[model samples]
Structures are given as structure tokens and as C-alpha cells.
Target: MKEQTLPIIDTDVHHSPDKKEVLAHMPKALAARGLALPGGNGFGNPHGVNRRDATPPGGGEACSDPAYTLEHHFVPNQIRYGILHPAGLLAAGVSADYRYAAALCSAYNDYMLESWLSFDPRYVGAILVAPNWPEAAAREIRRLGGRPEFREIIMTSASESPLGREQYWPIYEAACEMGLPVAVHPGAEGNGISNRPYAGMPSSYFEWHTSLSQNYMGQIASLAIEGVFNQFPELKFVAIEGGIAWLPHLLWRLDKNWKALRELTPWLTEPPSELIRRHVRLTTQPIEEPEKPEHLLQIFDMIHAEETLMFSSDYPHWDGDDPRFVLPRKLDEAARKRIFYDNAAELYGLPPQESTVSEEAANSATPTN
Candidate 1:
């Protein structure tokens, strides 16, 4: 029997927008000043971060040209939908000037809506919010959240404090009101005004990248223990580009600690792990490769992956995963379908694809030996 093709909803497709274009949308005073977004940690990738071949034929940065990206990435990969997370401005959430950060975010969103999301129906937008200014971020969410193209709210994982703090609650409130999930992507860690890793800053991009998941672990634990989910039951969060191997371990430790110290927080009526399972979803990219592939599958089961894991290509980045070979072949078709399409479709409230519906029906009707 020929293998069936599954629909893909890539949750982390990145596009690098030109700064001038983004600035064009900003207030004339800021645009005239030519302010740039905050820079990343000095630990640089000596060989660079983007794939060489991903550059557009028209001579722009990789993933910068919407048409080229659609032709090269979406068509070739058979991606039914690609969530656009603008690359360069992800660090705006960490800027010291909260007002400036908020303005930059608004400009970037306008640029994205005009340049990328409008270029194709397949492209979906994630509303960029400045976490430092919760009110401003909330305003931005309220401004753009009702749009059909915009499906999720995004902020950088790098921050002065854990995301669950009361300061960030307004953003969550707006997201819930808009029926959108909040997503945290790592790009500003140890950069600008954001706090460094708990273990202190790493010396190289390699070291920094390896420890990226630490921020996610901290954020997820904070959200659960602080009762963020309890306050906004409708809110959902996507931790983009953070590897999944650490999830099972983090939840295990969280559950054990909660059991021993239930008195510390009276509001938590259930285990931290249960709260995390219900509110958090993660993308699979830069997926952990254990010595035995089966070990990865075991991790998936521990985390209830079918309900929590979503597929992300992190496209055009040097370390991006190819949907074709990212998952283990041993994964059953049902699980594969959920990760590849269903989980994201449900999370983003995307309509069911006709192809996917027909494919499911065909599979169910086939006779088995």
C-alpha cells in the first residue's frame, strides 16, 4: 500500500523582514531616528545562523521574500499552513524602553500584515507583543487579535521575570478575550534588558542554544505554580523552538515538588503537571535525538504528546527540521497525523482541510489483514 500524505500546519515558520520596511510603519519621529531592535547575546554563530541556499533568487535575506518563501518552502514541503513569526524583532519584548518596544511591535505587526500575511492565504500571522508593557501589549492584542489572519499572540521568552507574574496578566486577559493562544519564542535570551540564563550566560552560541529549553522550563513551571491557567482557563501557550525532551523531566519534578509542598500554594487544586498538560503545547523542531529512537517515543508518551505536541519547521534557519525526516518512523500514523496537522489546526482554530477529511475516511474504510 502506498503511504498516504498528511496535511501539515507548521507552527514556527520564520520570516526575516527588512528593517526599513518595519520602520516605515513606525511613527515618523522613531523612523527618522532609525532605531534598531535590540541585539542578541554577543555569543555569535561563527558560521552564521541562516541556511545559504534559502536566500531568494532576487537577492534578499533568506526567508525575507514572501513569494520566494512560499514557492520554495510551502509548495515543496506540502505545508497546508505556515505561521509567520517575524525573526529580527522577537527581541523587542526585552527592550528597556517599554514604550519604544510597544511602538516597535505595532510597526512590525503592520509590516507583517502588509508584506507577508497579505501575500498569501497560506501565511498566518502571530501578533507580536512587548511583554515589558503589559497594558501596551494588551492594547496591541486587542487591536489586531480579531483579524482572521492573526491567530496567536507572541512574545519573546527572554524577560526580567517569569511570564506568569501579575504584570503579564493583562496580556493573557486580552488573548483570552480575543480567543487567541499566547506563544513564547526564544530569541532574546541574555540580550538587551532581559535576564540571563539562571546558570549565568553561556560563552558561545552553541552553549546558549543548548540551554534555550531552560527558559521554557522556568516559564512553564512559573505559569503553572502561579496559577496563570487558573485565572484564564481559556488561554493557551505555545513554546516555539524549545525542544521537547525536557518537558517530561520538568513536569515530573514539578509534580513531585507540588505533592510535597501543597501548602505553599492553596490555589493549586491539582498537580502542576496536570495544569501544564491542559494549558501548554510545544512545537517539535530541533527535536532531541537519543541514542535509541525508541527513547524519544517513551518521552512522548510521558508528556501525552498527542494532545500537546505540534509540528514546526523553523524554516530557513540553519537548525530547522525537515518535516519529511523529523519524526521517528516507528510513530504510528494516528500519532503522526495529530502532531503534523490536527493539534495545530485545533489550537489555531483552522478549518478542517477537505483533503484531510477524505483521507481519514479512506483510511477507516480500508480492509486490514
Candidate 2:
């Protein structure tokens, strides 16, 4: 199949609500405080965040206009589904004032539902929740999780504590009850009131961006070693925009440590790698490109890419991937199909497209399990 002909489900397309619009959804008192969503730490991108061509013709933010995004991004790319992650609220989880953070997240969800989701059938959203206030976050999940357009719950990776602590169990429970996957997206690390990067602060954006994967490693290890999967078997955790290459090493180290320390985590009946394979999913953007293309393929195989990986454009961002050229051309067609569409479709409960029926049938006949 030609690259253009393949069905695509972009799992990390970003869209931001107009600040005035989001404020309107908030309680008047909270809105009056004039608190905006927390921006990232001081390291500035030398190049701007959005692609030069992404700005809407009407002169607004890159993805702030749904109609413009559909025409310029989804339709042109033939994306069957575009999972909207709010760019502005990516750091909301790290806000110092927990009540304001929760209120801001709730407001963002309302803005997405009314402004973006209703505007297009292809647009689905991740429910933004404040990590600091898990009970309030759970309430937000319960409030909007039933909406067909909201498929997952999202929070920033930057947090005062790792995500697997019991405080976050309330949010996970609500997501499980609503059958929504919980996702962590980067942008908040070393930002606002959240904890600084594990290696202290980086001196440049280049250093910081390269080190983003460290945050994912810590969170994934915490979630696995802390037995989050054991408590919530139905839960799926997505690490979005975090590169995939480090996963093999992380999983290997986790399994190695667990072997010696299994008694400490009795709830983890199986290896950490096994639990991660079952409960965690990752997106492909800023995918690591090794000098030898085959080396990247080896990493994919090591991590069981067919089951755990999904495609994401990170649309409108400066470093977003293009569906036509992101993965190596030499990758197997069946695996490409799974990465581009099948895996995400299954995770988000989207129906199979006629274009992919043949691949789906072949895959089902030889199930990965």
C-alpha cells in the first residue's frame, strides 16, 4: 500500500483554547484572578514552537482554529482520527494552587468539548486533569469521560511526586470506571511549582528536550514497580511525545531489579516488562533515528512495537513527524499498519476502516497474544 493510502490515527495533535474563551468557562471569581495555565520552565526554544506554515489564515494561534486545522492538517494528511491534546494546558498539572489548577483543567475540557470536538467528527480529545488534586481530577474525568469525543485523561509529566502514588489512584479509578486511558504528556518538566528535572536543570532547550525521556522513565518505573497495573488491570497509561528508544533499556533494568526485589512488590506478580506490555502504550513522534536504520528496527522489536506503539503527529509543533516519512520505509507493512492506525484505533475504540480490513484480518488470524 502507498503511504498516502494508509489509514492514520494521529494520537497527539495539539490545539489550544483562546485564553478569553477558556476564562469564560471558569467561575467568575477564579477567572478574575487572571491565572493562566502554567508555562514551561525558563529554557526557551530558539526556534518558535509551531511550524511556520501552521498559523491559520485568519491570524490566530497555529491550532486554535478547528476548521483551519482540519483543512490544513487532518484532511491533507488523510488522518482518520486526530486526538486533540491541549497545548496551553499541558503544564496545568504543575500549578502551585491545586484548586486553580483543577478549575483550569475543568475549564479547558469544557472549551474543547464546545469549541473543537463539536466542530468536527474526526476530532477526539484527551480529558485534561490536574495531577495535584486527584479527587478533583477524578471528578472531572467522571464528568466528561462519557463524552464520545473524550477518549483519554491527560496530565503533565512534571509533578511533585511520581504518578503511581496512592494519591493518584483516585484519578486512575475514575478513568477505569469510565473506560478511559490515562496519558502523560511532556511540557511541564522543571516548570512552575512542579519538581525540577531529575538531573537538576539543563542549561539549554536542546539539553532539556533531549532529557525529556528521563521523566517518562521515572514515571513508567514508578507505575510499574508501585504496582499500579496490579490494582487497575483495565487501566492503560500512554506516554505521549516521549521518544521510544529508551524503553528497551528501561524495561530491561526494571525486570532485572524486580528479579532481585520481587519480595518488596508482592503485588507485581509478573515481570515489570510484562505488565508494561499489557498496560502501557507509547506514541511515535520525535522518534529516535539511529545512524543505521536497522538499529531502530531492532529497538522496536525489543519493545514489542506491534502491541505497545502508536503513531502521533504532535501536529502544529515544530518537531512533529510526518506520517509519510516518520518510520523507516523498510519497516514491514503489517507493522506499519499497526503503528499508523490499528494500535491507536484499538486503544481509542475506533472502528476499523475498509482500507485496513485486509491487514486487520491477517493480524487477527495470527494474534500477537
Candidate 3:
């Protein structure tokens, strides 16, 4: 019998273009404000840098041209690396030109459907939406409903409205109705200006990247305690680009608070941890370093229950870990099967993998670390 090749899907893969590429289709009035147009360059992330010093073992030159790379090199590289479902760029914050932001976002989403995800049945995409305007976001969600290529809805973790608030419920409800997963991807410092936190982490970029996940954890935990998931049981949430080790800590703290405030928020029928177990999913990307494979297993064993962790490559980000190098080494065959492919395929509703990664499998099939 022939062995099954693991069909992997990377969920948190981000495809945000530098300002210039994002404004490519803005309107005349809005295009003028887009960086792609003349004299339109004001936004930049203050804390972002590619100190990677080099690419992940097998990752090629996707960084040089992500917008075009996904169309050519990206998917082929993912396929060669044993990854099948490569979700790229569709979820990026493309509304940089605020005036025509919605139009720009629609064009980008359409492009994802036609240009990238449409390029291959195995590739999936997350539709980018601005939480700042819930009504407009709802419209986009409705627009893309049931599109096979667009299975997840991606948005920034930071928003004008607290994620737990009712103002965002319409967008949440729309996604649930459509059976799409709502995913939060953390953006950089210029992604939004924060009065707090950034003040202390001035010197280190790692400080911000690590803290970014915690910020989303805080918001998602707040929503869980606030009964967001309870109200929308069909709605699945994904907290992406953060490592999974923090899950136990965040869940422990959330459970602790709920114990005291059960009366305050009666809608929470179960503990915060239970809610996460049910409707929430977290992505593994930009991993923290560990000394050995056992070291990683110990971490996942405590914080994530195999299926809870999804595969992600912060593709094209200078420091984005090569999926091939960062994933296969840390997990055993069963664990790798799910994190690297199974869970992601299930998340995006794609075809399943034929085999799992074994101890010696990395040498033969070349699983992403």
C-alpha cells in the first residue's frame, strides 16, 4: 500500500503588503491617500524589524515579493515542504486608505478568491475586515458567505471597540451564520497607536511580538467570560500568531476570575477554559525557542490539547519561522499530523492528510519543524 502524505494547512499565514502594494486599487479620491499613489506614505510600524539574520531552513525568497510570490513561489514552496492548504494575504489589514478602505478591502478579498486561493483548491483564505466599523464589516461578511475559498474571517486584534462589546456582535453573528471562523491576527505598533504597554517595551521588538498574543488572549478571554461564545455557539474563534504555551496561564487566570464573578456575568454557563475548549482555536507561529523536542512536548501537553493548536507560518515576515524547520521537530507523529495538517484542514474544511509524521519521517518526507 502507498503511504499517505500529510496534507498541511497553514492558518495564520499573513499577506499584508507594504503600504504601496495595499493601495493598488483604491478610488481616485481614496487612491490619492493610498501609498501606492504619489505622495501617500505616512504609516509604518515603529517596532517591526527582520532580525532573523537569515531565512528558515527551507523558506525561499517569499519576503522579496509576497504580493506576487504567493501567486508563483509561495504555494509551490508550501507544497514542496509537504504543506497543502496555504492560507495567505487575504486576511491582511488592507484598508490603509481609510476613505475607500471598504472598497479596497473588497477588491483585496476578490483578488484572494480569484488570484490566490482560486489558484488552487488546496489553498484557503481569510477575509480581512475592519472591526472599527462593524456595519461595514458585516456587509463584507455577508458578501463572502459560503465562498469555498474564503473559510475564515481575519481582522486585527486591536480595535476601536472592545472585542467583548455588543457593537461587534453583528459582525460576529454574520460570521456564525455563514459558518466561517473568526480569527484575530495581531498587527504591529503602527497597526495602531497604543497609549499603554508600548511605553515600557521600547528597546525590544520581541517584547511587542510576545505581548501582542497576550493582548488578544485578554480580549478573547474577556469575550468568553462576557458570553460572546455562549450567545453564538456556532461561531468559532481563532487566536493566531501567538505561541500556545501561554494558554494554560491565560485559561487558569480566566477560570479564577470567573469563579469570583459568576454572578456578575451569569450568561457564562461553564468556566472560561471550557469555552476555549469548545469554540476557540489558537495558531502556532513565531514559536518560542526550546532546547529539545521533549521540551516542546512538555509545553504543548500542558497548554494545548493537540487539536487546540493550529499550524501557521507568518509567511514573508522577515522572522517568520520556516514551517518545515519549526514544526516537525517539536511534535510526534500524532501531534504533527494534527498541528501541521489535520487540525488546519478541519479548520478550513479541507481534505484530510493521508499520513502522520514519524520519528524518521522528517528525513524522508521533510516535515516543517
lDDT of 1 by residue, 1-369 (tens): 333267788999888888998888888977886766678566688888889888999898899887778677776666778899987788888888787789999998898777777776677899999898999999999999999989999899999889889989999999999999999999899878888785998888888889999999999988998899999999899999999999988988988999999999889999888889989999999799999999999988998889999999988898998888888889998999899998999999886655433332222322111
Model 1, TM vs. native? 0.94
- Over all chains combined, what TM-score does candidate 2 have? 0.94
Model 2: per-residue Cα lDDT over 60-151, one tens digit each: 88888877787778766778778988877777788888898888888888888777877766778889998988999999999989989898
| Model 1 C-alpha RMSD to native | 5.4
Local accuracy of candidate 3 as per-residue lDDT tens digits, 188-233: 3333332133334344455565576657666777678768888898
Name the 10 consecutive residues with the lowest summed lDDT in model 1.
360-369
Task: lDDT for model 2, please.
Answer: 0.85
In model 1, pairs of residues that clash are none
Q: Could you estimate the TM-score for every candidate?
A: 0.94, 0.94, 0.77
Candidate 2 lDDT trough over 10 residues, lowest sum: 360-369
Consecutive 10-residue window with the lowest summed lDDT within model 3: 80-89
Error of 2 at 275 (Å): 0.1
* Comparison by TM-score, 2 against 3, better one: 2
